[model samples]
Target: MLSIRNLHASVDDTEILKGLSLEVGDGEVHAIMGVNGSGKSTLGHVLAGRPGYTETEGSVQMDGQDLLALEPEIRSREGLFLAFQYPVEVPGVTNLEFLKAAVEARANHRGEEPPNASEFLKQARALCDAVNLDQAFLRRGVNEGFSGGEKKRNELMQMMLLQPKVAILDETDSGLDIDALQVVADGVNGLRAPDRSFVVITHYQRLLNFIEPDYVHVLVGGRIVRSGDKSLALELEEKGYRWLEDEVA
Candidate 1:
């Protein structure tokens, strides 16, 4: 569903991603594991077309269309979703309002009219239930007073409601406890379908235990250096990333 080739990206004046390349097929989940400053987050930001990151070279394509050629909003509307590691808290915007606007925007992109209030609410309630979030959360400002885990759950809730074709989860497991992590994982697993794909960017291997990926990639020095199955994750966890550093060097 997504292909990135020789993607070199830099923020401000410093280069981050250097010739990163990967492919994610439909219905496949790929996990990107890397240490801090290894460009894992940069890859996600670049894919979503976030500002401050300049693509020095390479191409990112969704299906067969050039992804970097489109704007950020267009990327989201065109079935691309990125769940940030730190979800911003909008003081005045209720979660319901935010989600409705997103859902309507995506619907309009497909030449379909927005769902009416009743229909939208029904879908919202279903998504809320799927994420194990309460209806009360819908009435609150987006992540205003939410705990860390609550924020992650809210992010997953948005992903479930939007139903994007390719979802990029950037460190969704950072602050989640075991129970909360399972809830978020369940929400993600429920969204798995034949036409959907996922790129899960994380630091630890625990999340992989919940949502086993089709492939595990070790990203070092801004490039993918190793690719394997689930067992690779366990090996990385046990032996640490020294082997990856050696291989990349």
Candidate 2:
């Protein structure tokens, strides 16, 4: 469903991605693993059109559309979602309000009607239950005063509600305890479908244990240095990125 070719991006005048390329077909879940400074998160942010990250080369297509040519909102409207590694707190906006607006906008984009308040609330509460979040959280500000695990859960909630065609989760496993991790994984697994795809960016293979990616990729030096199936994750966990250093070089 998504194709990236020769993607070269930079931040603050320093190039961070060099000739990076990958393809994620419909119903595929691809896991990206690498050490710090290897551009795992950069690739996610670049795909989502994060501000100040300049793309000097390469093309990305969502389905058949020119993904990079659209504005960030347009990208969202076109069914691309990026779950942040660090979900920011917006103290004034209640979670319910934010989610309603987001859902409505996405609905409008697809020429569908927004759900009634009661129906929306019911769905939101059900998603909360699925993600193991308290129903009262809808009254709180976005990520405000939430613990680390709570923030990650909130991100997954957004992903579930948004229901994008291609979801890019940038280290959704970070800071989550075993219990929280399982809950979050369940949220992701529940949303799997034949028409959807996921790009899971993580540093460790532990996340894969829950989500079970269809493909695994090793990203190093701003490029993908290796690609394999789930067994690759286990191998990386055992051998470590040290062995890949020489291979990437």
Candidate 3:
């Protein structure tokens, strides 16, 4: 569903992703494992067209369309979703209001009218229940005064509602306790379909225990240095990235 070729990205004139290339097919789940400063999150942000990160060279295509050529909103309208590692807090916008606006914006992009408020609420409530989010959360301001786990749950809620074809979750496991992590994983798994895909970027394999990605990739020094199946993740956990250093050397 997504293909990135020789992706070279930089920030402030310093390169972070150096000629990284990977492909994710529809219905496939891929895990990107890397240590800090390894450019995992940068890959996610660059794919989502976040501001400030420049793509020095590369091409990102989704289902054969030029992904990098579109604006951020265009990316979202085209069924791409990015679950931020740290969800931003918008104090004045209620969660329900924010979601409705987003859902309507996407619908408008498709030449469809926005769902009425009653219908929108019904759909939003169903999504909240699926993600185990409290109804009260819908009435609260977005991420304001929410706990770390709460923020992650909110991100999943948005993903569920958006129903993107390809979802890039960057470090969704961070700061989440066991119960919260399970909830988030269940929510993601529930969204899996024959035409949907996921790129799960994480540091540890614990999240893999739940999501069970079809392919596991080791990203090091701003590039993917290894690719294998789930067993590779267990091996990495046991032998560590030190083995990768030797292999690369």
Candidate 4:
């Protein structure tokens, strides 16, 4: 569903993603594991077309469309979702209002009628339950005053609602406890389908223990150095990135 070839991206004139190439097929979950400064999060930001993360070389195509050429909003409308490592708070916009607008925007982008208020509210409430969030949260500002774990779950809530074709989760497990982690993982697993693909970025293998990616890749020095099945994640947990760095060096 997503294809990236020799992608070189830069932030503030310093190069990060150097000749990175990755292919995410339909129904595949690819986990990118790396140490600090390996550019795992950079890959997600670059893929989502975040401002200032310029793609200096290579190509990214999502479902055959030129992904890098589209604006971030256009990318979201085109079924590309990026769950940030640190979810920002919108103080005045209630969660329900934000999600409803997003869902309606997506529907309008697809030339479909937006869901009625009652149906949308019902679905939103159901998703709150699914993510272990309180129904009361629907009335609060987006991620406002939420704990780290709550913010993470809020990201998953958005992911579930958007149902993007390619979802890039940038360390969604960063601050989650074990129980909260499982809930988030369950939400992600429930959305897995033959038409969906995922790019999960993290520094630890514990997240993979829950999500169980189809492929595990070790990203170092701004590019993917090794790619394997889930067993690779286990190996990383046992040995850490030192072994991979030695191999790359």
Candidate 5:
């Protein structure tokens, strides 16, 4: 549902994503594996149109629309979601208030009516249970004072609520424990549908063990050097990026 071709992006005049290309079909999960500075996270940020991450060349299309032409909020309304590696805290905005606004904004974009406050809260509470978050957290500031795992779960919660057509998870497993990891994976798996796709950007194979991506790609020097089935992830785990680096070299 998303297509990226020869994408080149830079930050502060330093290029990060160099001639990167990827295609994600409906219902497919693609895992991007790479060491630090390999542009894994940069890919996600550029796709989501984060400020200062400039897309210098190439095209990104979401279901035939120019993804790069849209502003960040417009991109979200167009069904592109990016879950950050480090979720920032909004001290004064309560989680419930944030989620309600997001859901309402999406509804308005789609020309649909948003749920009533009570019903919305009910659904939010259920989602909190699903993500192992306490209902009380809905009253807390967005990700404020939340532990690392809790923040990740909060991201997942937002993803669930947004129901984006394409979700780019930027190292969502970085700080999660085994149990918390499983919860995040389960939440992702639960949202899998015939029309939805996910781009899971991660470093290790452990996250793959849970999300089970349909395709695993090795990114080196800001470009995807190899793509394969899940077994490729196992290979990377066993031998690390050195073998792949030599092959690419």
Candidate 6:
């Protein structure tokens, strides 16, 4: 459902994504593994249209629509979700309020009616349970006082509630403990459907143990170098990126 072709982007006059290309089919989860500076996070930022990552070349499309042409909010409304590597804090906005606004925005964009308060609360509470977050979190400021694991869980909570067609998770596995990791993974697994797809960006293969991706891609030098199945993750865990670099060289 998502296609990226030869995407080149730069930040602060330094090119990060050089000829990067990846295609994620509907319902397929793809894992991107690379060493530091390989542009795993840049691909996510560029796809989600975060400001400052200027696309110098190529194109990204979501189901035939020009993805890079749309504004960030429009991208989210168009069924593209990015779970940030470092979820930021919104001091005054409660988590419930933030999620409600996001839900309403997407609904309005899709020309659907917003959920009534009762329906919203019920669904929101269920999402909280799904991510193993306490109901109290719904009342707290968004990520303001949350620990690293809590922030990651909250990101998963957002992913579950939005139900985007294509979700890009940038290092969602980072800082998560084993239990929190499984909780996040369960949230992802529960949302799997024939019409949904996922791009899971992570540094370690441990995440693949819980949420097995349909394909595992090794990104290097700002582009994808190799695409393989789940077994590739295990191999990378054993051999490291140097093995792939040698092969490419």
Question: Which is the leading candidate under lDDT?
Answer: 5
Which pairs, if any, clash in model 4?
none
Q: What is candidate 5's local distance difference test score?
A: 0.96
For model 2, which pairs clash? none
Task: For candidate 3, report its TM-score.
Answer: 0.98
Candidate 1 segments whose C-alpha is farther than 4 A from its true place: none
Against the hidden reference, what TM-scores do the models get?
0.98, 0.98, 0.98, 0.99, 0.99, 0.98
lDDT for model 6: 0.93
lDDT of 5 by residue, 1-249 (tens): 999999999999999999999999999999999999999999999998889999999999998999999999999998999999999999999999999999999999999999999999999999999999999999999999999999999999999999999999999999999999999999999999999999999999999999999999999999999999999999999999999999989
Worst ten-residue run, lDDT, model 6? 44-53
- Assess the local accuracy of residue 192 in candidate 4 as a C-alpha lDDT between 0 and 100: 97
Q: Write the per-residue lDDT of candidate 3 for residues 1-249, one digit (tens) a residue.
A: 999999999988899999999999999999999999999999999999989899999899998999999999999999999999999999989999999999999999999988999999999998888778888899999999999999999999999988999999999999999999999999999999989999999999999999999999999989999999999999999998889967987
Output the better candidate (1/5) by TM-score: 5
Task: Give one digit per residue, the lDDT tens place, for model 1 in 3-24.
Answer: 9999999999799999999999
In model 3, the Cα lDDT at residue 131 comes to: 79
Which digits, one per residue and each the tens of the lDDT, describe model 6 over residues 1-249? Answer: 999999999999899998988889989999999998999999999888888989999999998999989999999999999999999999999999999999999999999999998899899999898788899999999999999999999998898889899999999999888998999998899899999999999999999999999999999989899999999999999999999988887
Question: How far is each candidate from the true structure, as Cα RMSD in Å?
Answer: 0.9, 0.8, 0.8, 0.7, 0.6, 0.8
Model 5 clash pairs are none
Better of 1 and 2 by TM-score: 2
lDDT of 1 at 31: 99
Total backbone collisions, model 2: 0
Give candidate 4's error at residue 82 in angstroms. 0.8
